[model samples]
Target: MTGTIKIDNAPLNKFHLKITAFTFGSNFSDGYALGIIGMALTLIGPQMELGTVWQGLIGSSALIGLFVGSLLLGWLGDRIGRQKVYLLDFLLIAVASFLQFFVDGPLALFILRLLIGFGIGADYAIGPTLLSEFVPKKYRGSLLASLTVMWTVGYVVAYFVGILLEKAGPDSWRWMLASGAIPAVIVLLLRIGTPESPRWLISKGRIEEARQIVKRFIGPNVDISDLIADGQSEQHSTSFMMLFKKKHRTRTAFGCLFYFCQVLPYFAIYTFLPLIFKAMGVKDDILGNILLNIFLLIGAILSLWFINKLSRRTFTIGSFLTLTVSLLLLGIWPHGPFILVMLFFAVFTLVMSGFSNIAQVYPAELFPTEIRGSGVGLTNGVSRIGSAIGTFLLPISLASLGLGPSMIGLAVVLLIGAVISIAWAPETKDLSLDEASQTPESSSQDVVSSSPRKKMSSH
Candidate 1:
């Protein structure tokens, strides 16, 4: 008789959960601030006496700063440690968020938003890396994806807050902008208590310290000594050029292309959604904004569910296809009832939610522990440049082409993203960070060598 054996997976510990919560909190703050800018720009344009050109510039200012910060800070995250970089990012975002209240004109607001974008751009790359490195392989996807959930919650909170404060008149936009400071404060306090990533420590030759952190969260029952030892042996002296080596070149290329296309459609749609609704005759701006938040929340929840269940490649492709189809449908039939508009918007949000959540996890998984932060940041920085372009161009498109053509253009961009995702991306689902970091070319070689070759009979 043959016996079946089952291996039990370890659950996350209290420390792991606590640290993840803090990370989630920080992400929520960053996401809330970003989401607010999208909606606020839509609502504040008329109220602030700003033209569409000025509005578009102000909306994209953060993205420009994000482009710069992600590159600079992402490199810094790898050179320093994930935890240390994350700890300081909050203060930067908080100070920037508060300073927005002092801005009196478009130029001033644009500069302040740029600073806010820089801080958020830094957090975007660092937050996911911190969460993924700290958790075990089994729960990493779900835990990291939960950042999307927190992000939705933050958006929802901002939506209601904006509505309530709208009654405070145009001046209340200052308060809404200032509210971003709260997350920075929370992150600052929580960061003081959070520890650095153990995986990062192991990569840096601080094995003993890494071991203690593992013991605290993973418990002393399992034998992690061997795993740590293996990591130490395989640790190569890392540099930025190492990311472009033959073995890693494909992954680096894939990461950059995937992120670039992903952001193009995402920011294009989001930055213009409220304006689209207004153009569609949604008279009540507050109500339209509230509906947009609802869709965002729904998308966040659905994304959290599918990110772990489905393959990363599958999710990215599927979401892009769905978004593309929805945008096409909206373009084909420009005039629709309120229900149809809501339905389409919901679909758009749902797909985007999945894209946002999965995108973060995939890039982090593609690089080694030592350079994971840089990998994520570089892609994010590149993606933000795309976002900056999209943000800058959307208003121009809307002015010249009208809503249908504008949305059709966005759908075309999403279709391109879907194709790139399918053709170039690898499936990282259920793989450990170490395993996921293996280049596709090397992994294919291993697969071929592992297979037994049959001897050919002599003819």
Candidate 2:
């Protein structure tokens, strides 16, 4: 069970931060590419002479790709390894982005956009899982929480790019879309120097290689003597079905349900923000979209500050509550003053940011290393189903119900999310990935079984 130990003076926190930063950078690039498509769709649609239905179809093409990719590639990451799949995904994304430059008609653009979505969907599942596996227990939550920071950076970059591209004229949108290829190139290059997950290696019985990778981070001198688990001698391989085994089924279901609820309302609100603003009498679509991105940036920044300060469960619940109230207000008074509309948008951004920050970290902590990737991927894949439904149905709902009723419907969904989160999600603020994976049922049994059995002697 024991392995070679290393010791060093550098803080473990510093190493974790570096690893997180690298992963974050890669994700930032992927997210920027994805965000731009959503932001620029309005401008690109009409200039290309697309009708309402066609516009919706073009915009949703990427999401359709994402929905499929998340399930297939996410499962692959779990079955093979995170690093290998991640590197391959970056390459695919680069190719997709490069091809986007050549899109001339609706069918061509739709296909290219769908490929880009596939890359994004794969990255979404693998990136966070890689980052979470590499960090130490003490800083895991905050370190993993930082993925949202990268996501925001991408969104901000897209926001400015959208504004600039709008003025860049008709041909300029092509360049703006293709510009996303640059980051993919960078990530592909940078990831070549990165190591595979040490824990994954160890679980797969490649102890020496795992030790070498761990040594790179913890320094050559630090003692991992106490960190290695006795169970390393035992096999730890897992399959997708293992997630639903007797001991793990409830945990897997909980994780999947939480992710589903998290995305249901969040995507519903986000995908329709511009439309909602227009309904509220904001005639300028570009301006409305830009403002939405700004509010999203503000929310992302505030989330970084509060995510580590509060309990994961508390912050998540509070965020849902905040979103619920904002949606309620917006629903009740769709034609309110500009200031009130802006207020709701701002609050919506803030709460959604908080929810997103916490939500990404939660799944990474929910399963053992053996099944962590599968568990996260499965949950995320299921969540994408909800997102697909939201993306497809929200505009239709808005069309029929008006902005007010649409907001109210989303508010009710968020309320349901808040209730489910409070009931089933466990607190995992400071626990290590492995410790958090240990089921509550097992822990309770340990407590009960260890109690003294001296009743006969007393009688």
Best by lDDT: 1
Q: Which residue pairs come into collision in candidate 2? A: 6-221, 6-222, 7-221, 7-222, 8-221, 8-222
Displacement of the residue 328 alpha carbon in candidate 2, Å: 1.7
| lDDT for each residue of candidate 2 in 1-459, tens digit (9 for 90 to 100) | 234332212256566766676677544764575567666666677778876566556656666676666667777877677888777777877888888888888899888878877877777777778777776666677777778768777867876786677677777778778888888888778777667777677677677787787777666654544335633656665777888777777667767776777777666566555666677897775666667677777777677668778866688788878888988898898888887887787788767865777757888877877777777777777776777667667777777778888888878877877876666666666555665676645543332222122212222
Report the Cα lDDT for candidate 2.
0.71
* Tens-digit lDDT string for candidate 1 (1-459): 123211113467786687778777655775676567776775578777888788778878888888777777877888788887788877887898898888777888898888878887787778888877767777888778877678778767876777677678767888888888987787788778567787778777887887676666666654455456657677565576777777777678778777887777667666666677766676675676677777777777777778867867678888888889998888877668877876776788767866777766788888887788888888888888888888888888878888788888888888888877666677666766666676645643442222121111111
Superposed model 1: Cα runs more than 4 Å off = 1-9, 42-48, 284-286, 442-459
